[model samples]
Target: MDLTYVVAMGSERSLVVRPPKLNSLVELLTSHGYSVVGPILRDGVVVLDFIEKFDEALIGVESAPRPGEYRLEEHKGAVFGGPVGPMSMKRWINPPNRIAWSARPEGDQVHVDTPKPRGPRAYLGIRPCDVAARTIFGEVWPGHPDDLVIVAECTSVGETCFCSSMGTGPAAGEGADIVLTEFGEGSVLVRSRSDRGAVLLARMNGAAATEDEIESARSRVAAAAESMVRSIDSEAAREALASMPDSAVWDSVAQRCLACANCTMVCPTCFCTSINDTADLDGVVQRTIRWDSCFTPGFSEIHGGVHRDSVAARYRHWASHKLSTWWDQFGTAGCVGCGRCITWCPVGIDITEEANRIIKEVAHA
Candidate 1:
């Protein structure tokens, strides 16, 4: 349980663990004082939640995602059958509601207290796109150093996924501590990307993977990337948004958009928040921070009036910020191509389609 072992021995080696042995990984994490969270079946969908055992995870569950549609179907004998669920790593890192601080009157003095620190946590079975999303999110809201990230490389593509175009996945990227690739034959290839990951992996005691086994697992991930149907050129989309503010595509999309903030809520990278303060009769004042959306009128409200008064304007601002202006502020696009926005949106408003439309129109103009 001593996690301070930082020497990365055999960091370049790939290890193979049989499916039944996966439970040991969870036990190992728990023994090391890490709270493990992974995908679980809830309300007929896969969602990220705490898991005490490996059986609690959605092992054979695959997600069917389309514009305005999402379903969890059984994929017999497949591990990590889905590309991603509706929830992302954001929910755990930045919760929906959190107490910033509290102040109480104590006999002619005020006592202020901040929330207690959360202990170390491990995210198991996280998808590569979400791994990328977590990295982008950290730029705005820093993450804990003690948290561990275990990424599951995609072997099957989702209908709305576009991570290939975004250069985020199918294969695990740089942020992951441990990367797992399931071959659908009751075995998984595991690789460590960091010193902590290497130390933990060594404890799993998995056998060294053969070159053929490693090549086959990587080939499956490559096939997943090629099979993706939806995509948008990030550079072109950025240029399109900057050049065509008055494009008719905004009005057309606004007609279908309800401005209910579903897209922003489901988006992995949207980080807008609002702070509220409440006081009780007992002279206790509590301040809390909660997630907010740009689609909300109050979000753009100033001293006089709301800046984005119409649905068209609000939609324009959101899509622009995600694909174009985000680069100006963060030096990277805000979206990681998880496709949650398209799947969860009530009206099936596809950001990729909308961005592509702008790009098409700008090309002819």
Candidate 2:
């Protein structure tokens, strides 16, 4: 995998690779000591998992995602079919549960041991919305420079997708090293966004994309954006949520919300974590970090009592933080509009609908 040819080539131009040739790219990554992870069909749905070959990827299968439901169907139209699945890049970058460190008492001296570092990871077939979510995750939990981001720009739109409204997708945005847009049949347009990506592209055997092919790819992405029916005005939603703390919509949503934290669990940008400490009888102590959700009553526990004791308050906090105060804190909205929260929730709580309701209420008042 000599990448010096990239420097020799000088120009980083888009190329069109046949679908079957993607395995060569995977092999190249593996040769460079990268553990390639891509979308694969599991339990009747597409999920991100480790892959050694491109055929293992969940290609030619489109996902139909709606509120409270998800279904997969065969579609020979594109290579990578779905927008996204329940899992995001967060699961690999920041795990659900991780042992931060462990300590042992050794002859009146305390010894601390941290977990070993993982090898470089290559995220393949990642959607643009999840790419944006990964950017947000980098802001809070920064440190995965070795990770390679290979984005699969959305050519097909899902029922619940709203990434266009969030200004995050349909086309791949920042944080991606390489971008791939699969056109009908076997052709895929690949572009390099970073030097490392250029190196990979240089090694790949492919023809330079024609001007017509590029324009066609762009048109497909634009069509996907236009097809999105669900949306939220980020600025308006932020203002609405900030102004209405006592809005009855909270109570209404709370009535429907099960407070099961399924939304938070599936959300790509929800990085709340809880720390747990345990000691063994042998005097070894371990500290672990696990994913936590604001929907949980214990999440807001205090000396007096739980701050957000009511389900309504909890719902309000989660929604407001996602669309409102998160701007003040992170300079960006926490929600990337992937619609996983909506699709995976048992009762189908739509964030865009709630945000719009809040905005409408504020306007009327």
Candidate 3:
């Protein structure tokens, strides 16, 4: 590697190294027995999936996201220009559909076996808010500690991004094994936060980064932070929602909501699921679990009928659970402020705007 790519290394963790040689990193991680998963453009939208090479990744593509509208735009050399897409990291870790267990009937006895996970997976280009969301998910679906988290500092913020108010960031703050900051033109600032990360950087043989190079990277992050346009006071929203369960905001939000469940599927931390079994000719059955959304009427179904009969009731349950009761269940709010729910919602409902309105109403009350 060139001397310009080199930077300082420290036992205390932060080190600067090569800029955006993402393909090489993919190769290295794959060789080290990790299933390399990263961002890629498919059908004019970015989705997180298993990527074999860096070229397959969305290196120069950007996304224009507004409430209920998303368009893919090409940016020739601007990697990391698009903030996030509809698919969150949840798709890979806690898949939408997976066989929970299988059972076969032989005479009067049944044989059953639960599916096991494959090798460790490495996630590239993850943002800080997504990292926080994953931490919230870990409380439910625990993964290995050694699973590498390669976080990228945002070079540009999305219009719907509210990570700033969530304190999760345009810049990744902890929970990452390795962090990357893009300084444009294929130059990136790399930092190894863990011993495993340090070992990986040492193998690259990149030169030390100078003081000026580090400062330049910081400036880029600051600019991205200032560019954020959406924000929500999560704490105040939680309090308001908790205090006003019978608030009229539900009817208002429901009028705009389609009960499509797109928001829950796109949310990185939403983890509701349902289980069912299927049988074939030989009396073989496979029980599977599929992702379930609260917006669906059957999700709250009981013996007589669905508990949440109206769309307004279902919407209320979803939002109230997300901001209010989620704290009592998960010890933290279930939202990471990725804003996927806003951009992908067919009706252009903005969660942050709704949250602020709820807070306003509660204050007036």
lDDT of 2 by residue, 1-365 (tens): 11101111224354444444667778889988899988888888888889998743455678889999999977665566577889999899889999999999999899999999888999988999999999898888764689999898998888889999999998999988888876656466777888898888777765566667677778889999999999999999999999999999999998999999999999999999999999999999999999999999899999999999999999999999999999999999999999999999999999989999999999999
Q: Could you give candidate 1's per-residue lDDT for residues 103-189 as a string of tens digits?
A: 999999999999899899999989999999999999877678899999989988889999999999989998999888777464567
Stretches off by above 4 angstroms in model 2 are 1-14, 55-57
Rank candidates, TM-score, best first: 1, 2, 3
Q: Would you list the C-alpha lDDT of every candidate in the order shown?
A: 0.84, 0.85, 0.79
Model 1 has a clash total of 0
lDDT of 1 at 190: 78
Query: Candidate 2 versus the native: TM-score?
Result: 0.94
lDDT of 3 at 272: 86
**Count of clashing residue pairs in every prediction:** 0, 0, 7
**Cα displacement (Å) at residue 345, model 1:** 0.3
Residue 205: error of model 3 in Å? 1.1
Clashes of 2: 0
Please give the RMSD to the true structure for each candidate, in Å.
Answer: 3.8, 3.6, 2.6
What C-alpha lDDT, on a 0 to 100 scale, does residue 275 get in candidate 3?
A: 89
Q: What TM-scores do the predictions have?
A: 0.95, 0.94, 0.92
